[model samples]
Target: TSTGKESVNATLPVGLAMVRAIRAYFEETGYLIGFKPAGGISTAKASLDWLVLMKEELGRPWLEPELFRFGASSLLTDIERQLEHHLTGHYSANHRHAMA
Candidate 1:
């Protein structure tokens, strides 16, 4: 389902449906499925939103690194930049964080 656009709009519904089907069909709750959204998810806010979505939809267990991961270097860079801003009240230059 990699659309190369990295849109929550494109992916969220599909994820939700899969979870719904799993819950509906499985009698046991021990099965775990990892969710990783990649590509153009390049913003701190979007990453946070994805976290919230996973938390709300899939619960805290999915928040673990092994279960949930982001696959975008730009997203990592933006997250670092946001963290720096939050800590120092100053944003690093865009060039400071290089995207892979």
Candidate 2:
């Protein structure tokens, strides 16, 4: 690849735009349209950022799976790590929790 980066990484900014669009659509329609940012979202920090962005843009309801979903296993893995860390004051290994 000329750019030396995967195409998915290039689309990160689009995620923000997509979330904004989701917010706009919800504002216009009064019915929530779910957001699923597929591909290249394979880390916990990125997942958390997406979640925070969603919660900020669309509020708490969007945090629900019925409204939001990540297309990567590692995304949920990181979120679980964060939750475990929150509850226990220490982060756990990625392999510790079974993926849902």
Best by TM-score: 1
Q: What is the lDDT of residue 94 in candidate 2?
A: 67
Candidate 1: where is the Cα deviation over 4 Å? 1-10, 21-29, 98-100
Q: Where does the lowest 10-residue lDDT sum fall in candidate 1?
A: 1-10
lDDT of 1 at 66: 86
Candidate 2 on 45-94: residue-level lDDT in tens? 77778788888878999899998877666567777888898899999986
Model 2, global lDDT: 0.74
- TM-score of every prediction relative to native: 0.74, 0.65
lDDT per residue, candidate 1, 1-100, as tens digits? Answer: 2555644533566667765554454447667767676675778887777788878877788799987887766787788888999999999988887663
Worst 10 residues of 2 by lDDT: 1-10
